[model samples]
Target chain A: MLRPPYEIVLKPYGKALVELARERTDIICLSGDLTRQTETDLFRDALPDRFINVGMAEANMIGIAGGLARAGHTVFVNTFGVFCTRRCYDQVAMAIAYPNLDVKIVGFMPGLSSPGGPSHQAIDDVALMRALPNMTVVDLADAVEISQAVRAVVERRGPVYLRLKRGEIPVVSEASRRFSLHEAQVAKKGREACIVASGMMVPAALVAADVLDANGVSTCVINSPVIKPLDAATIVAAARGARAVVTAENHSVIGGLGSAVAEALAEAGVGVPLRRIGVADVFAESGSREYLFDRYNLGVQNIVDAAWITIAPTKPVPAAPAMPLTAGTYAPV
Target chain B: MQKRARLNGKSPGGCGDGRLRAGAPAPVRVGDLARLATRIRLHAVHMVGIQGFGYLGQALSAAEIFAALYGGGLMRPGWDRFCLSPAHYAVVHYAAAAEVGLLHPEALKSYGRDGTELEAISTERTPLLDLTCGSLAQVISGAIGFALASRYAKDDRRVFALLSDGEMEEGQTWEAAMFAAHHALDRLAVVIDANNSQVDGQVNSVTTLEPLADKWRAFGWRALEVDGHDADALVASMQSTASERKPLVVIGRTQILGGLKSVPATADGHFLKLDPALKAAVIAELEARLA
Candidate 1:
């Protein structure tokens, strides 16, 4: 049977926000003149009165969101992920987190999703947000997850840092499924190895699991939307069932999903051999999404190789092969 | 409403219409506001004296401006929103808020102390302080947002914010200014304490904001300049609608360190904790001033 060509489906990050504003009058959308980039234009068009275009002022946008949030308004401050995290970290930490204001920061183009070079990449956003106290960090896997993620953040009090992927994103999960902040969704169940992933990495991890399954490696894929208040119980349970565990994320290995998973495994006294497939500690150059992924060892093959290495039927699987040095650009699997 | 009209009809004030502008308020009590300003300064000095550590100089310089807003009836304490943007000058804001009965006087003891609601910086934990001032030039955005909300809710209550002249160096301040003006947030009023002092040195000496009033006007705001210490004129300007149809920015010209008899005026009073002898002398001076 001939299958239809693969298509990139546009996600509803802005649509969901517009709908939220329709339901809740207090929901306001603020953009730093990146209305089209962050896709908050949908909200802006639906509720022009509630939308605020703060020009190129990212810090002011956050401060304004802080004020709106303090006044009992659900403020959604939008910009690129880099600007949201690195450009104005102090505002996000103190203005939004310290006082625990109800402000949701939506930063689109997480990780290598943007082709605007290293400056636009928000690879360290999750790591930076996770370090802040009283912050809820969530990275969506697809459109279906965003539907749930947006509602969860809006309903819950306190500040939230939501990573968004703009433009046409491939849908991996069912649209009917509900998204829980603290709960980890087991995309697929297996026993040989547990593959934990987040945001856009979930689809990649699922594909890697399939490849691993075809090669006789039964992999369990866990989709963790909440990165900061991580679903430790689920991760620990899944990791315990498998002799080895692997983590995949669309961010730098340091202080992100990989680091969180490592900390969780160590704290829970789960001594499973672990492998992390993500961007190495190096400045990512300008390239297409696929080019950046393969260049930074975040491709499906990297995940497959990492899972196979970790799934070795031995105590503490040797991590030498998994830690492949970046010899040259796009090292073929 | 009838009583206020009758009062304005009798008072020879710039604010004869009961609006907070350069016109004198209907019930002009300049002497009482002046006394309140002195009390706020004394409270600030006393707070700095507690630990022999605080932003005493800027606190003293901004005392009258705070008084004009809180004590003078332009800002109805709890009713009006005062965002203290320059977090270092929290002593000034805390004293003014306490003086107007918005915060309990005892809260002064915990100024700069750990576990106290009163943080060294102007945080939301403090009463009547709506914004948690994190960095410089950012609080104006909060005031703008508050104004937007007030209009959205169809409330006439104005949003007030105090910022330092040194913070003009931050690009976000102008960003907020442009936003407020573009939105025509007439309900939002900002007071720039142009004390000409920062951590580096004189604000203009560091980076000149020459023709600052022109700059504000260029950004679509009704800008004005006034002696920060003149409580009456300052209150009148605040009450009047002279700067209507847009946001207002009052360039409050003030001394970096003013009205301190005991505490030696430093080149920069961004933060100061006087020596023991100086601290004692300052406390004595405040007591005599209060008496």
Candidate 2:
């Protein structure tokens, strides 16, 4: 079993952001009635003028943030991942992304963070945001990492889409641990295989690495907090050194962390057997977080199994590239 | 000039072109405004010719109105920054900006070129523009924000936004209209190019904004309708607008595909193919009008 850091957990990320907001008066928080769920209510209670409740209008909320950003305010717009991605995609691309405004979109309840059903689950946010040219996509592994990522986004003046998981997530870093945006962090080191994971899957990969160590298979666990701008050098070195790679994420296997890793390997001309363990292309049904995790094969056992398969001598054939998408063709209104 | 055209025995079109004489001296010369409008049209035609396709039809239709605003001194020409909502009139906007000395004429020629800062839609990179506009109805809300900020700073700088009739289909436009109205954004003036046509067909066939004036009134805006091509009428209405407690919307009715017969009015004006002869004719007509 792997141990989680206790100093700074996931829930405090929102609280820490509020504390930071006190010093930076320009930071305004807007929520689509998900303040309690995303832990942004902690900030809202403290700064009423700086906090705006846009009701349930995710699309309008994003527009308002973009407007505020244009007026030189560092605005943070928060909502569930599903609504933030699919519901208000046009606002993200046109208002926030295209304009390159200083708006940080915090998508809470990413992947199966909620047991509310398919509607609440956000499995394709990374894929959706990464498609845009100028957008910075981030998936924080734990609460401590979340705070660091939030501060980094504030300092970096551009549009950022942050995918955050809800409720109590295991801590993946210390409060004092500093990391740069768009850089990958090494959680565990080994030579036999490398386990690359993002967001919620980082903790699972750590557990799987411990399990692999007991089984006499050494593994290196890398936490990729930033999804877009993939941190090519770090990922490439990890791929070049390891015999095989296992990628994990709490998102769709199609366009999340796994797909990003594969693209990096192919671009660098480094050939290694890779296994992607994530939710397949299907909507998650209503169930507890544990049920969904087990159902989608996103647990420690699955990661270990995938890692073992990747390192096996008999390598599987490489998958073909998916069909190309033309501009303005993805999702139509 | 006070020709009373009434509906239901009441002056429905309320105070026609006669209101111009009563206004405190007009901001711009009528002939000069007309010349500026012709130049805007000529520039739009050439810009579209360079692209091989563009929203020339709507651009030409909106030229006179844009000219009136830019040339009349009602809006600070080189100093006032604009937030354009309906993005199809890129060529017209750039040309007007150049004529007013806000941007260099050379920069206008560089539009749509590889790595050019002048994009089809208004972007903040232009410096003269405050917000990027392409997706419909977004600029209205953005303008509201800018207007509110100006109010906070106690600045008299106004936010001028130009919207399209077709964009009225977007619900956010109405939301912004209501928001601006409730806040009494008198320093903000929105000009709607109501050419009566949009992509697909006539706006009535797609989404009708009949009683458009009533809609603005319901949203608590002081609405005024004007002949879009008549620069003098537009200048008068703009000058007489209340500047303290209420928002204003100038619904300048225009002829769709104006000055060009081949350009289909019913089609979406974003992309259009112009024949060489028609292009020359447009250029000649604009030059002659300006001369």
Candidate 3:
């Protein structure tokens, strides 16, 4: 599912939400004045009556979302990942999460995907959301997952923090493959090493698996969309037999996919050599996704090298060349 | 101003779900509401005195506002929603709810106990408060949501949010004020208990928020200033919402422990520590007022 000539879907999340709202009258969409940028403009245009532009007040927007949810409407709060999570975390925790309201906080531009630097990048959103009780944290890997996830979260009760990448989203998976909130999809299976990754890093992890396979290191890749309520069984099973386990994410290695997988492995008693590929604990600078990912050591080669290090400790793994990216080209599985 | 005048002429009909207790007298006039306010204070004294220390000042200051809201029947139990923005004021809310029959009087005994619904600072588990996050200045935003949702459902039920003067210090309160006015949520009303009291001393000393009504007016709301201790004024001001297109903000000027004179002026109203002697004096003072 992860290869070049990758089909790009424009505003799949916004369109999917609009379609969902057409049938579900209980759905209400609120935006913190980033409607067009967050793709909530589609929902605003389609369902003008149900759409509320709450200006730039993120805290009030979250509170209003909570109130709407309390009034028996499932609310979709849309804004940048940074604004929705870190900016209004208290409101999200108190107003929405504490009561376990049915408010879907849609945070666009996850991790280093935003060139808007530290203020705009939501590098620690998963950690923040995961810390809150009754908060379902989801980081969709592709357009297919995003489209399916919008409906999947609404079906389940309680609050959800869904992180999405804005603009042209890559469709890594088929429409037939359903998105599950409780499960992880094993994209590739191998015997020697396993690469557990989520969101933007999933594609890179897939490409890294291919590179490892070619280098005579058979690697398995697991695509985890749900960061919280992690499919630990699938991860632990894959790690149980593998010689090396590598977890990758588009977030800091501190409290996201890497930490979650590490916790799962430790609790499950699956003692395997593991490597994490992500942003080292530091505030990121403004740059393109490609520049930031590579600069932060989150490229495909980084994942391949990390996987190799787990298996061969003392020897320095051979430096692999960076993968070339073209228009509509996302690293594939 | 004319709308305010017109509302003052006729007493609000207790048309909402009868909020008074089963045996309690129905509040029919200004005097009835005033007496109800005193009863609310007495109930609060009982609850807070049981805990030795609690947010007694909030109850004392917001007594009349709650009486007009709950006892005077401004809020319907199942129909309308009430948001207690200041979580610490849960003591006052629980007392008022007990005073009205929304909660049993015996249930007030469990106030602030571990594993009890009546938390010292209200959480989601707290009874009676429709939306409370155990944080100050945040619940008003949720009240705006309720008002917006009610508008969508075509339900004419109103939402009343009780806020502390200190909450104005928070930026989110003004954000919610701006949103409510922009949307013209007429059914939503906010009662600011400008009790001039907070944990860090007087609200004015900490954050100089003078000309509070003007601030709300600037933010596009129909601002009404009234003696917060005057239950008639609160009921009248809240009832005047029928003609208003914009959201209403009733700035009720009040004093901590205003209705009671037993506590010294220098005493902190935020959290009152009732020694056995002070507790007896407070109860005696409130009991005489109730009589």
Best by DockQ: 3
Model 2 DockQ (Cα-based): 0.17
DockQ, each predicted model: 0.28, 0.17, 0.37
Which ten contiguous residues of candidate 3 chain A have the minimum total lDDT? A324-333
lDDT for each residue of candidate 1 in A1-333, tens digit (9 for 90 to 100):
000112345547887888878998878888888998888878777889888888888888887887776665778999989999999998787667876777899988989878998899998999999999989899984767787678889888788999988776545566567789879888888888889999877766776777677677788899998998999999999999687798988899999999999999999999998888777877798987767887888867778777776555453322212223232221112
Would you give me the overall lDDT of model 1? 0.77
Candidate 1 ranges with C-alpha deviation above 4 Å = A1-7, A313-333, B1-31, B265-268, B283-291
TM-score order of candidates, top first: 3, 1, 2
Better of 1 and 3 by lDDT: 3
Superposed model 2: Cα runs more than 4 Å off: A1-10, A312-333, B1-31, B46-54, B77-80, B104-127, B151-154, B178-186, B219-222, B236-246, B259-291
- Alpha-carbon DockQ of candidate 3: 0.37
Candidate 1 lDDT over B1-291, as tens digits, reads 001122100111101122233333232233587778888888887888878777888777888888887777676433456678888888887787787665788878888888976777765555456553757887898788777766766656688888888888998889888888888989899988888888877778788897889999999999889998887778877777863699998888888677665656553477675778887787787678778
TM-score for all models, in order of appearance: 0.88, 0.83, 0.94
lDDT of 2: 0.74
State the C-alpha lDDT per candidate: 0.77, 0.74, 0.83
Ten residues in a row with the worst lDDT in model 1 chain B? Answer: B7-16
- Give the winner by TM-score: 1 or 2: 1
Better of 1 and 3 by TM-score: 3
Q: List the residue pairs that clash in candidate 2.
A: A10-A143, B199-B268
